[model samples]
Target: MRVLFFSNPLVAHLLPQFPLARALRGQGHTVAFSTAEVMAPWLAPEGFELLLSGPSAEEVTDEVARRTGADILFSPTSQLVGAYFAGARVDLSLDEALAAARYWEPDLILHEHLDFVGPLVAAVLKLPSAAVATDPALEPDVTEALTAAARTRCLERGLELPSRVPSGRWLLDLCPPSLERRGALSPRERIALRPEPHEGPAGPTRARRAPVGDRPRVLVGLPHAAGATAGLGPVLRSLGTLDVDLVATTPGDPGEGPGLEPGRVELLPFTPAAELLENVSAVVHHGGSGSTFAAAARGIPAVVVPGSEAQQRQAEPLAAAGAGLVLPPGRQDPASVTTAVGRLLADPGFTVAAHRVRDEIAAMPSAVQVAEWLVASVSARRGR
Candidate 1:
């Protein structure tokens, strides 16, 4: 079977799909990724074919501003977020996406939750598409808004809109039981798939991790999205005061951030979360699902300083589950973050909760199993 993983230009959304891609490829199925040209460098290391379509996030944001005068990053509402992804993104990306999909002739299109272009391609081709749900689409109202915006874009493209959000078809859920939002999907339509942290290079193992230092190693990774940087500099400075060695991520020059003595803080660019999580005691991140799940999967407690509502959404459930702590903008400070990390390192309960989540994730269907299910589901649906 041939599978095409589809998303807009967001790396976080696309990251969850990689495990399944690995599974399918291992089983001798063809796999490719479809997105803008900007994502080529990101996915190149994975060695998947890039169908390459659509505009960069900046271009989409620009189009949204020109069309609706809405700045999605600054003040994001459901309607504007819908416009950013479903409205402007669809309008700008549909033609190229259609061309790209036509050339690839994929047997199935697995799209990220917020992406509409893939389903549109499926609709145009009369093919089956399922959602690789990264985040829980908890709000039916927000889904409706996305559907409405997609409807406008579809009409403009002389195509029909999908009947329900996600096209209300098969949903491959990555969320665990405790962190799942209320009323996200019907049991009949939702398929549980285990979530794994994005793996990077084969680095040190748990046994090999002793060389760094006897002191606890804490990872401080904020999301790379625009406006998702909150308390990164201050949090780093505070953590430096503690007895823990730090691992922080930087998209640009590692030399550009807050200065700490050499070997005190390690700044990495594009190191896999799996590699970084190894031997780490706890995590401090922007509460992105990518980071939260990575830490939880390894039973590492976390301190979440959210930079966006989406990040905040991930933080709330984690704190509720006792796996982590949340520091909103009002409460986020050098001292608060330091105390949270310190508490996480010292508290046994948090480790217990983190282990609970890890076990729960382990109990979910593995990516290989889900890949089989995806192929069977699509094959049956298409009568192939």
Candidate 2:
């Protein structure tokens, strides 16, 4: 089987799907993963074919800066909503992504549906495609409800719906089921998973902090920060003042604001996250599916500060399962972040809950099992 996977250029969006792609390839399927130039090298060592498009990193940074500055006065919610709508209209990169898809002549097109161009490309080529949701907010149930309301909106722009819902043979709800309260689906709708990342290496267990004098370890990340609220800097600064080893997911950005001074934060740029969370004491993040599960696989407690409705949507499960704390975006001030961090750090109960969920996730099926199910579905439909 030849599988062509389409993903946005964002690192978080691409990493979770790599395990699934690698699993398929290990089973002797031919798989090619495509994304913008910024992501080419990151996916290369994993055996995925790189696909470049649009501007280079410098160009994207410049554009994002100009746009962000121009829109900074708007509320974060407004700025994000405007950007999301604008992106659907101007996808110059889609042509490049589609060209790569055509080159593969794939048996299936797996994509992050939010990219907006994946389904269009699949339709044009008459290829079967499955939406690989990176966020629990886009799980089948959420999509079903949103799609029903969005049909008129999408049709207004001349978009055509598939004859039926794009059958998500395998909806990779990357977050532990407990961390996605409203987003959790029936057992049949989700791919069962082991507590460990099947394809990735194990996580860490300790760290030595030079800047603040090593104390305990904390994994700090905001994988969905590209267009989300920019608030991690202050939180990082406050945490840096504490006696903890602080490791941030990505390198510091100029506009990310205070608390990212050199030696204070460890930036794990393009490093696979599953390998980083193994020995961390806890996580402080914007409730992203990838980060949530990466922490859960190790039974690590969390302090989630959501940046959008989609992120807030994930807070329910995390709080319900006693796995983490959820602080609203507007309210995620220094004190709130400190309190959440303190609770996760001090409370042993949270760790116990995380371990309970970890045991359940570890017992679930691997990506290989999910891939086989997807193949069978596609084959049966073709035979009909």
Candidate 3:
């Protein structure tokens, strides 16, 4: 079978689909990507056939900002979601994406949750499509907003909208039920896949074996999308005061910051959080879905300093699950960050909860298993 995958140009958005894509390829299906030109380089290294759908991510972001008159980085979740769907600039790539879809004529369309173009093309072509979750907490809202936007766009183009919003057939859920937003969407089918930890282009280079020492090891990682490393310095200084050994992946140059205590904090360039999690006892991060799930998959507790409303939402469920703690909004300073890390380290319950969540994730079906199901589902539909 041939599958067409669509995603926004952002690296974070694209990484979630990799495991499944790889699995499908291994199963002897052809998989191609439809995304912005900016993503082409990243896709080239992975050997996937890339069909250009739009301009660079930077151009699209700027376009969205120009159309909405809001900094997407700082905008509220609702505003960002609404703007992303309704903004004229966001749709600039749709015409090309549709043309690519028509040319490829894929048997299946699987897209990252935020890329509405997948569903729109699927509806127009009367092809099967599924929405793959990137951020579990945001999928419902994304589905609603994208569905409404797609419906309007379809009508304007003199086409009928699909019965469902983003997906004509299924919602491919990678997150465990416990972590996802309750009743986010009423999909015709929900396919559960184990959340495999994969670090795409930016993953760690050499696997450093677990830090060999008596002192507990803690990892501090900032999300690339966060775009600023200013907050990391203070947090690093605070973690420096603790007795634990600290390893941090700085957003920018690690040398710009004030010197941390020699053995207490070690700052390095961006490495995959999953790589670092293998050696760490606890994590302090910006609470992106990838980081949060990576930490959980390894049974590592986290202290989440949410950088946005969506991150805040992701953090809340992790904190509630007892796997981590969320630093209150505006309390992401040195003192608060230090205190949360201290709590996670000192408390045994957090470790216990982390392990439980890990076990839950481990119990889910692997990506290969999900690939089999996907193929069977498609074949069954064809037979009918």
Candidate 4:
């Protein structure tokens, strides 16, 4: 079957759906991604076809700022964010995505839940689509904002997408049952789709970091929306107080602050999370679904410092499961970050909880199983 997928232009939004896409391909389904050019680097390496659509995230952010006269970068409201995803983004993306889908003639369409263009494409083509939830449930305001804006944009385009995207069809839930917020999805078929760390072109080998030795090793990451972040220098430096050796994937130099032991922390350009997590005792990162699921999938405890509500949504569940701890945006000072990492490494119970969550994730159905289910659902819709 020809399956086409849609997503926002960021890796965090796109990577969560890779496992299922890979699984669908493994089952002999031809799949392609319809997204912005910024994703080409990620999608190409994964051997997936890139059907370029939509503006890059940075462009969308710029557009939003222009339209709203407010920069919602550090602090964003649902309305402004929704304006980008459902309003501005739709205006830019719908035509390109529609063109791609028309050419691809896909039997099924799947998209990240927040990506507005997907639902509209499905509506215009009169084809079936599924919403892939990258994180646990979003807050009601977020969902409603996106839905209302999407509805508005569709009217502008003379399109007819459903009011509630996931409710209109399937919701491929990536969150394990233990961490899922109940009733986030409608009474639709919410399938369990396990999350996996997106591997490099050549798999984990190409991205592996050097071996660590002696003291406990900790992995650190700072993601700015999608890739590694450069803003965690204070937190990264504070780790010097601990005995653990550090490896960090940060975009820019995380200059060492006072108290950080020099040469103990190794910094690199964006490395795969699976590679960075190898032989590491714990993770310290800004909360993102990709990083959170990577840590959880590996039974590695984490210290999540979230800068936004979206980040908070992904962090809270893991912390609730006792697998990690959260440091809210305003509270994650150097001392607090240091303390959180220290606590996770010292307490064996955190590891125990992490493993329990890992076990739950393991018990969930594989992507291949979910892929088969998707195929069946599509065939049934065609009255096959």
Candidate 5:
């Protein structure tokens, strides 16, 4: 099988798919990736064929805006309304995907559910594709809410109402049903893959964790997407007052940001996220699907700060599992960030729940099993 994937750029976005990619490669399927050029260096070592989809976040955003006349800012809410209209400028991304497909001629397209172009691209090419959600889409209510929100965004963008919306062939819900109230899957969908384990170096064990003390070690992840940064000065100053050591995952040049001095905060680029989760007592992240899941997989409690609706929706399951705390931007303050971090470290129940959920995620079938399932699902559908 020749499989192609379309996803957004960011280390976390690519991490969950690694295990599946490796699994497919191990099964002798030719796998190709179409993502930001920035991700190519990191993904090259993993042995999958790479295709650069778009040049910069702005270029992609501009193209999406030009193609659909949808304001980029409205993407957060517009993504749910319908498939024809997009919230973000996706023109270049859509073009790149079509261009890649022309040469790759994939047997199937496995896509991130929110990419917006995957289903359309698949339809145009007459190929079968499945929606692999890094978060929960099993809840019809959530999907409906997204649809309505998206519709509102389109109306604001001056785009016409979409006459048709392409339905996905299958929905790959990454979350376990236990955490969701409406977790049941349709006969068309299959729950096959769980979050894959960190294949990178195992940093340390729970027994090796730093003793609870005044300077609690905290891991902070800022999503690499445009406009995703929140002012960290206030948070850093607050944590400084608390005598905490901060390790922030900002790619390169730690001293570039305010209050992030050499000894106090380490600014490192692209350390495998799984490896970073090992030493930290708590996490402060942008609530991206992969980052949230990575922290949950290790049983490490987190503070999820979401600026977008997709991120807002992604935080729900972790909140439900009692594995992490969600703090939206309008609600964020130095006091809130500090309080959330402090509480996550002090609460024993949170840790226990996080660990239990991690175990559940770990127990899901290996990536090999998931790849096989994806292929089988596509083949069976074609036969019928």
Candidate 6:
């Protein structure tokens, strides 16, 4: 079977779908990607054929901002969602994606849940599709908003919106059961898959860092996006005071700050957090789904400093599960970060809880299993 994977122009959105795609390819199926040109550099090295679609991420963001009269780069969840799908961002890509789908003639499309064009293309082609959730905070309200926007687009294009506009034939849940979204009955079939770590192409091999010593090692992973580093200086200063070796992953320089010890802190450009989690005792991050699940898979506790309401929503469940702590919005000062890291380091309960979640993640079906299931399901549907 030929499988096509679709995602928004963001690395975070694309990474979660790779493991399953790889597994499908291992089973002798053809796998290709449909995304914007900006992602071509990252996808080409993975050996997947690319069918480029849509405008660059910058163009999309600028258009959304212009239409919604709000800067989409830093907008809140509701505003960003409204501006992205309700605006012409999704529509801009729809035609290219549909053209690619028709040419590729994929039997199935596995799409990140947030990318609306994938489902629309699948519906138009009458092909089965699966919505892969990259984050844990897939609220019903958000789904409804995206669905409504997609329906309007469908009507405008003279295409009929499938009964399942937001969700596809399957909803791929990667979140641990404890962190899964509640309070909504999804209209599609829910299939749980273990969250596998797949960071973009590792540039080049470097000498591995020395193994952890007596001091605890912590990873601070702030988003690479512009302005995501705001207020991060204070957090780093707070973390420096503790007797721990710190490794921070940033896109550019993480300028020097008050308490930063050069010898104890190492700043590198965009290494996969999953690779770093193996040697770390805990993680402090912006609570992206990739970062959260990477730490969870390694049984590392985290201090989630969310930059948006959507991130905060995802972080709350980890705190509730005892695997992490959520640094309150207005209180993300140096003092608060210090206290949270201290708790994660000094308490045994957090470690125990993290290990439990790790075990649960391990128990979930592997990518190969999910790949087989997909093939079987598609065969059954065709037989019917």
Q: What is the C-alpha lDDT of each candidate?
A: 0.81, 0.64, 0.79, 0.81, 0.66, 0.81
Put down candidate 6 lDDT per residue, 149-257, tens digits, no spaces.
Answer: 8777778777777455346889888888877658533656788899976554553334567755688888888776666566566667788888998887766664564
Give the poorly placed runs of model 6, Cα more than 4 Å off: 77-80, 139-141, 162-165, 184-187, 199-204, 227-231, 253-262
Model 2, position 141, has a per-residue lDDT of 44
Model 3, poorest ten-residue lDDT window?
81-90
Error of 4 at 349 (Å): 0.5
TM-score of each: 0.91, 0.73, 0.91, 0.91, 0.75, 0.93
Candidate 3, lDDT over the whole model: 0.79
lDDT tens per residue, model 4, 1-384: 999999999878888888889889989999999999989888887899999898898898898898889876755788887787888888989899999899889989999988888888888898888889887777677777777888787778797655575434888888887777665655577788887776665766544555556788888776645423434566666787788888877555545433456657777766766677788889988877778888888999999888676678767778899999999867788798889889998899999999998998898888899899989988987995
Worst 10 residues of 2 by lDDT: 81-90
- Model 5 lDDT on a 0 to 1 scale: 0.66
1 against 5, candidate with superior lDDT: 1
Q: How many angstroms is residue 333 displaced in model 2 relative to the true structure, after the best TM-score fit? A: 3.5
- The worst-scoring run of ten residues by lDDT in candidate 4 lies at 223-232
Q: Give the range where candidate 6 is weakest over 10 consecutive residues by summed lDDT.
A: 198-207
- Candidate 3 lDDT over residue span 1-384, tens digit each: 999999888888887898899899989999999988788777887789999887766676677788768766566456566557534434787889888888888999999877777777887788888888777765556556656666677788787765654455788887876677775555567888788666655456765755647888988886655545766677777887888888878765677544765656677786655576766899888888888888888988999988776678778888889999998788877898899889998999999999999999999888899889999999999999
lDDT of 2 by residue, 288-309 (tens): 7777777777788888887667
Best by TM-score: 6
Error of 1 at 43 (Å): 2.5
